[model samples]
Target: MNVKPPSNAIPTTATAHAFEFSQVTSSAGEAWIDKNLGASQVATSSTDPASYGDLYQWDRPADEHQKRRTATITTLAVNTTPSHADFITATGPEGPYDWTIPNIGDVDDALHSAFFARTDGSGVCPTGFNVLTECN
Candidate 1:
């Protein structure tokens, strides 16, 4: 439970003033601070600050939702309505998908298929870390 920032991260003057890093170990672990990469719960209007970190729609990359990080929206649809039925006919191949449609059980529906995980390198985790998978 030693809390360390990612190696690629830089410490800014503001960050240095805001956070204190210590080598002293407690039962919980060593204390450190890092940039909030959308995983921090902060006070925002219309949301509960203490509840959870930012909530993301499925299949959307974490970059687009995080505050400190620049948003790179890769989804095909932005605000379009999704299909209630089995097939997602509107958004084409780019999707922030719901696993219910086109049949999650069907092997041909790659989006809903259990085998489908992002093959693309657009992962959400910090540098030097990987998104944990079922295999891990």
Candidate 2:
């Protein structure tokens, strides 16, 4: 899923820490948010702070770590299900950083899943809603 890093991904994510899921549905059965997750308002521009919402680690759960002001921990999780809520920072352009990515995988591979084999979006997305698959 080398998604072209859509600029719309953020503006599509605000408000309320983005914990609210599946609040709206399209006629084609597509779900979307009126506001970016964790954002205070819908995005007006790339510099709109309110629309920045919270930063989510790929596949990470909608927990405290998603908060914009959450503390950062320089440690990477040993497993997919991290028990804590600290924003894990990338180890620069050196080594693996996040959980959803493979240690030796491509930097552009948005769908890289070395340890992540599940496609159900469990633990990350709210129940009844799932992270968009590559085919979506």
Candidate 3:
């Protein structure tokens, strides 16, 4: 499951082999990382904003194509504080992904504050959008 931020909150995503691409777009690449890999574990910068790429645990693989890239990280809980929260992966004139959104649920309550529609136009939840149930 992907961990999506609240509609009121900013959007964040998982990191990928950004530089590997012929031409890298800092914000676009990082947004993909935040949405897919989860938030970064280190400090963020323009080059590594939100530190999305660093979130994964890349290990050499037997396959050459995957060898250069590290393994994906899959051991994170849905408990990040607002101050240190790095979920907002993309912003401004850098990314194509939308961050401010809301998922569908018949029940409207404070707990459902974070749930949002997975995609911009799709009524259904996005394939990997993570649901945030509780906010402390």
Candidate 4:
């Protein structure tokens, strides 16, 4: 699945670097996040970049959480039901925010396996890209 970009794809002033692409089946692609995303690894050691690009939680935006050294505020305990109070002081929007409850089949469950593309125009991703949804 390696693709060489067209000559025009590279900017005239920039040097093109060799990029590698690996072919993966649908099932293997679905399992990638659990096995590699957010997992601890030596960034400078002899390693493959495909094994580690970045890690992200379910529906949360790609913030500092991806970096191992970055500190994150844990608002709720795992598997606990979150209340309005839990998110009252959150920096973002108002209460009744979306969150996934652990182990229960309910709306806003972060663990719910589905495709969730952000449409709110929050700019969660680059201009031409959309957030990658969790694969069930």
Candidate 5:
């Protein structure tokens, strides 16, 4: 059947190197990835290296920025996709601490939400999978 993921998800082939995907189903009926964000294989335990996949910004696309050796930056992106793969670190105290922090006067919350919510909404998520978000 056509089970869609709940919310918050991972990308498919959008990462620096072609990422791999495996489908998994939850007890609650939500669909999901078989591995972690950067993992190529399923994890065997909590401390498995496969458990800790790539380390990119949580807000950006799977665009190579989260590579193990990726560069980190302080400058924010002005658009949906960033030109560089550097992980965008948080700026100063007046915190717009997410990579989705837009240029001043640009206030579209969907920037990050879209990517994290539905893969088709606006992100790199695979065909029928998404990361899970908390429900209130």
Candidate 6:
């Protein structure tokens, strides 16, 4: 399956290096995805001499360094149906009818190598084949 990351979903160097990861699972046959955006709290007491401690302590003022952006992943099955010669002839030849976002984990795994690289859809979808369509 080919997965396309939402437009404007890339993270910057500072965000990527300090980011925490989370998983989002969509219900079968449903459209639209939900994930919490922003920096996650790191434990204050867990730090040792080797570390500088959590970025935001529980008792301290909440960290206001992160912004939230919601993104949705859509999936579509490739069509195997054939088109009419008249339709093809009248209009320019077209490719597949539609596509769905690839599984999130698949995209995530593909990005492991470039964990710190600044990027947009390049790291995730890599393939430039997103299209507009309806989903349930």
Model 6 lDDT tens row, 1-136: 1122344452221222233433233464222112212225322444432222222111111132111222212323222112211111111122242222234343333333343132342322222212122233
lDDT to native, each model = 0.32, 0.51, 0.29, 0.32, 0.58, 0.25
Total backbone collisions for each predicted model: 1, 10, 24, 3, 4, 4
User: Model 2 residue 10 lDDT?
Assistant: 29
Tens-place lDDT digits, model 1, residues 1-136: 1123333442332212122222222365422333222433333543555423343344434433433233433234432223221222234443444322333344354432222243232333332222223331
Q: How close is candidate 1 to the true structure, as a TM-score?
A: 0.29
lDDT: worst 10-residue window of model 4:
10-19
Q: Candidate 2: list runs displaced more than 4 Å.
A: 1-31, 92-96, 99-123, 126-128
**Model 3 Cα lDDT, one tens digit per residue, 5-106:** 333433333222232211112544322213223223343555654445323111111122222243322223222212222233333232333222223222
Give the residue spans of candidate 1 off by over 4 A: 1-37, 41-51, 63-121
Instruction: Order candidates by TM-score, high to low.
Output: 5, 2, 4, 1, 6, 3
Global local distance difference test of model 4: 0.32
Query: In terms of lDDT, which candidate is stronger, 1 or 6?
Result: 1
lDDT of model number 6: 0.25
Instruction: List where candidate 5 sits over 4 angstroms from the true fold.
Output: 1-17, 56-59, 93-96, 100-108
RMSD of each: 10.6, 7.6, 17.4, 11.2, 5.5, 19.8
Candidate 4's C-alpha runs over 4 A off are 1-46, 49-51, 71-116, 119-123, 132-136
Candidate 3 lDDT: 0.29
TM-score per candidate, chains pooled: 0.29, 0.53, 0.18, 0.32, 0.66, 0.19
What is the RMSD, in Å, between candidate 2 and the native fold over all Cα?
Answer: 7.6
Please, what are the lDDT tens digits per residue for candidate 5 over residues 17-127? 355755656796555566666676777887887667776454567777877778888876766478878888757433656665545333555445555666563444555
At residue 92, give the lDDT of candidate 6: 14
Clashing residue pairs found in predicted model 4 = 100-108, 100-109, 100-110
**Preferred candidate (TM-score higher): 1 or 2:** 2
**Looking at model 2, which ten-residue stretch has the lowest summed lDDT?**
1-10
Candidate 2's C-alpha lDDT? 0.51
